[model samples]
Target: MESSERQLRAQMRFFHDLVRKLAADGDPYAKVLSAPDNPYPAYEAIRARGVLYHSPLNTWVTADHELANQVLRDKRFGVRMANGDKVPEFMNFDNSMLGLDPPDHTRLRRMTVPTFNPRIVERWRGRAEAICHRLIDDILAKGGRFDLMTSFAHHLPTAVIGDLVGIPEEDREQFHLLSREITPLLDGVVTYEKSVSVHAALDGMAELFGRIVEQRRADPREDMISRMLPLVDEGSLTMAELLPLCMFLPLAGTETTVNLIGNGILALLRHPEQWRMVAEDPELAQGAVNETLRYDPPVQTYRRIAHEPVELAGVTLAVDDELAIVAAGANRDPKVFPDPERFDITRSSRNDTLAFSAGIHYCLGAPLAKFEAEVAYQTLITRLPDLRQAGPVRRRGSFIIRGLQEFPLSAG
Candidate 1:
């Protein structure tokens, strides 16, 4: 199994290198990195090329808000090839519903919806609040400067999702350690070593969840795994299907929320007036969350492949042609938003953002993620009224997922 896996990774690495060459030599992706802290200029270049610009790298790129929404909602565009092939040339990771197209996509997604129902997720609010306060207390106890991403942002969502998914507390550290390695593949820039690490992390997580599945089958509890066990037993969902669903929760829940907190806080701090606004009125926490998502979303790029020749943005996409919908750029479209560059929590047009994306593939845990950020930010502002940046920020090295990997902050 290990040898076969290594061979698969060798193929993936070769493919990644080929794609990198294509992107660097010909694609807009080559020019998309304006700076570690800002990629909007790169996105602006793509937008300037017109609504639908064809890349020499053999993909169609769009930063237009209407075009992005049309492509996402259009039935002709999907996550996979027309004939059902996976598109992860950098890593052999399958995102379940995130990878599937309708009837299959609809079926699998429907089964998971009840688990993430607004009411069910709302029940997690108290726990999310408690986690926020406990983390703040610990950071305060340590006295002066701490890495916000590591100390608070990363751990909070990991624990919340861990609890929600019913992973045994003793086993969660190993789970998170592995997830940390695997999440970067979302960026689509995988080195040979990183691909190997991702494979190992996925395998280890599968094993951990496998054990939990068996435990839930034997001694049912009030957790998500237990809730879904009956469906697995009766064949509404197979064991094979169950594992990925369990894996998706944390995979979906963690890094995005972590980045949201880190990026949103940074945005607020950079615009001190906005920070003061949220700090003064805790009610603006949700407004802050919305504005940050619009200004600097966690997931920066979304992809779709045409299932058939489809006319869009005054051009027809041949079957299997990839569409790189840059939502980060779309969120700032001046047609939809005035002064698109400014980060304002009070802007009425702010809700026009495509941060959680649009249409069917929109984030399932968006409510939970929003609530988590709200609580984290609200608590931080109220408790650490004097919070300020202590050191240089290190942005994550992936254009697809925009976030700060390390943000040093101090509370006076």
Candidate 2:
């Protein structure tokens, strides 16, 4: 089975590479879509083309804030195909709330709403702060230099989400590694190796979750999985839905929050004044988080398919027509934001950033993610007043999820 899957991924990679090469050649839209690294320039080029650019790949592209906003909220468009089918098989594993539309999406989303409520997430602030300080203490003990991505950003979210999901402490480290291995699935494209590894990692997680489910059944606790077990028994949710929903907790709570911290810190370091602003005044931490979401969001882009004939930016999208809503680009849209290229923590409208997207699909984890990131930034700036980049930062090779794979830093 593994061999067959690898063979399939190789073939997919072959075609994906061919299209990527041709796309990267002369077309800015293609380059933007195919970019392995910063796609900002290509985003600008696409914007220059028009508010809505029809790409050679037969998909609609939009960077304009208004258009992206429209596409996101319009009930005529959705994540699934016109026939109401889900996306490709490889892209569908544990998709959870991400893949559903309308009643189903609403159903699954409502079940998790209380978990991410602002009041509930606010209660996590102390926990997040404690985790942050502990990680920093360990880094401080290690001569003040560490890869922030691994030591701080990644582990912070992993640990918090592990606690939320009620995973045993002994299994948290292995689960963290598995979550990292499977994160590449969030990318727009996946290589043969990544595909195999992600599936394997997910399978391992499924096995682990299966055990947790049984354990929770035998001995219920106050954690999320334990809370949902009764729903499974009462038929409010099936075992299939419940399992994927729990799996999504890590994806929703871990990777994006990790990137939010990693990206926010990187942005502050790159802009010394901004760093000093927050470092001097810890009160500015929330604003810094908002600016970070605006300047370089963790999740860069999203796609939607037209469910029926719909007119957008003077062009009609027939059923099944896909559009790439570049949230990173939308965040930088000059029409919505003054001096969009400038990274200013003081920007009044920074809270309106599309980093968490908009409409019904607005990231369910946004509140918790914001709480985690704000606490993280405040802790780092206050604790490591002289933190600076220690080595070259390595960005994760993902077009969909924008984040660093490695970010060396000196906590001095």
Best candidate, TM-score: 2
Candidate 2 lDDT, tens digit per residue, 208-264? 888888988898876788888888889889988887787776676788899999999
Residue range with the least summed lDDT across 10 consecutive positions in model 1: 27-36
Model 1 lDDT tens row, 34-133:
2246788878878888999987656788999999988888888888889988885553366666678888888778887876778888888899889888
| lDDT of all predictions | 0.83, 0.83
Q: Residue 245 of candidate 2: its Cα lDDT?
A: 80
Q: List, in order, the clash count of every candidate structure.
A: 0, 0
Cα error, residue 206 of model 1, in Å, equals 0.5
Model 1: lDDT equals: 0.83
Residue 122 in model 2: lDDT: 81
Off by over 4 Å in 2: 1-11, 90-94
